[model samples]
Target: MTHSSTAPTDLPVMLPATYRGPDALGYCRWLAAMPVWALPVMAGLVLIWPTLVHAQTVYSTEKIMGIMAKWLPLLITKGFSMNVVISFFTMLLGTIAGLLLGVGRVSDNRYIRGFSWLVVQLFRNSPWLVLLFIVMLTLPFEIRVAGTYFSVPDWMKAVFGLSLPIMANIAEIVRGAIQSVPSAQWEAAESLAFTRRQILWQIILPQCFKRMIPPWMNWYAIMTMATPLVSLLGVTELVTLSRQAMEAEGNNPSLLVPFYGFALIIFFAYCYPIARLTMRLEKKFAVKG
Candidate 1:
């Protein structure tokens, strides 16, 4: 490449292709695209954090990281996996319930529509932590069905709690997606003597599917990050189990950064890609209304 000899060495680069190179947007994408473990590894380099040096033998950063490495499996299996499980189930349950609720919001019946709106507002406005606490406290520990008792697990309760908000948000997404379809489609379908149900299921809903997907993925990311809230309710998900592992390993001040920071790093690792893809889908499916 040819360049002016008088060119300043430190001017921001502009890539010849794709309009990228340490500019604001490119820099952000680059940062978010970093390896999953990159942030934690960076923290490890700062060895011997002054604030973490308590009144005891200061552990080397290498030893702190080694401790984290040794307990990595437990954190992933018992802790992180539960976060995944809770997020998955929450999204699943929420999607089903939300779809129904969304349909209800647009239902022809006044009562059904009113009830759906009320429910959506109530749950969507409620604090997530409060909902978790309410579900954890109010639900029976065990239930009887056909003279058989099955006990509810704490994590399951957390899933139920999280699902409520997800359901509300998704209900809104569904309603909006459905409404975004041009009214002319509905009118044209009706011109063909198609019933409301037929138009909705076959014509309207098919178009709404693409519009709904990006928001659905976005909500899943939000719900996954919120899974850590379960830790406060004594659920043994990633954050909760992370703390237990820290305690088992002596709860050194130095361990805090690596352990909790590791959790944050992995969560970002999981969510950032989804966020990027969501943006892409949103652009691809941009509804010209």
Candidate 2:
């Protein structure tokens, strides 16, 4: 008998073959170069596939669609409007408070500067939820404003809570923007015998406005997102309404993903445009500088 050795090429392969399709290099380059929309289309089809199969089996597609159709209008009109209203008041209150504190931060008096600094630090360091709870649960239900008695709404508490951190952030923005102005400009104003207030109002603050706007819009987007947190305080915002919709569907766990996904879409649709606008404004202001 003669001894025989197998060549490597003649041996049976034990390793799995590598995948070689459109994903492989030099294989269907056109597929690789397909438009990005194809990805979302494919992904969306895949995402809905499970739901489709389940609905076909369980006959719940029409039911889910019916629920969604009913809730959609409420979410858009009432829930979204509530979110916007709370956010607007929050921004208004925050901006006014922040402007005051920011100006106070740079004041000649040490007491005013210290007080503003303390206020900023206190609110900035506190957790937003803690502030929300404090405002919503701890504050008296009825408050006397301008000597008139009125009941404070839960949504108002949400705004008040949300504004605290916003105020601090805007204060910092204001302080930094004001301080960033060149000392030469201040000296020029002083040489003209202009009062500090006049110099600030006419020269410094005006310049700060452009700088402040970009950050202000950025913060507005953030605060708008945060508005959903008000739902935790029993305010009927988008997220809260979404929850109610899901529950109304007999607490169907399957509906959770769809409902929440719907809310996510709305938020993205709302915020993404604002974010893009903010970026554009920032670039425009930057180029002007």
TM-score of 1: 0.81
Error of 1 at 148 (Å): 1.5
> Mind giving the per-residue lDDT tens digits that candidate 2 earns over 1-289?
1324444574446334444542211211232234435545544653474466564455366666677778889988988889889999999999999999999889888999999999999997688888898888887889999999999888888889999999998898799889989989999999999998889889899977988887787778878877888888899899888888777768876666667767666665566667667767777887787
Best by lDDT: 1
Local accuracy of candidate 1 as per-residue lDDT tens digits, 142-166? 9899999999988889999999999
Q: Residue 234 CA error for candidate 2 (Å)?
A: 0.7
| Local lDDT at 131 for model 2 | 88
The Cα local distance difference test for each model comes to 0.81, 0.78
Candidate 1 Cα lDDT to native: 0.81
**TM-score attained by model 2:** 0.81
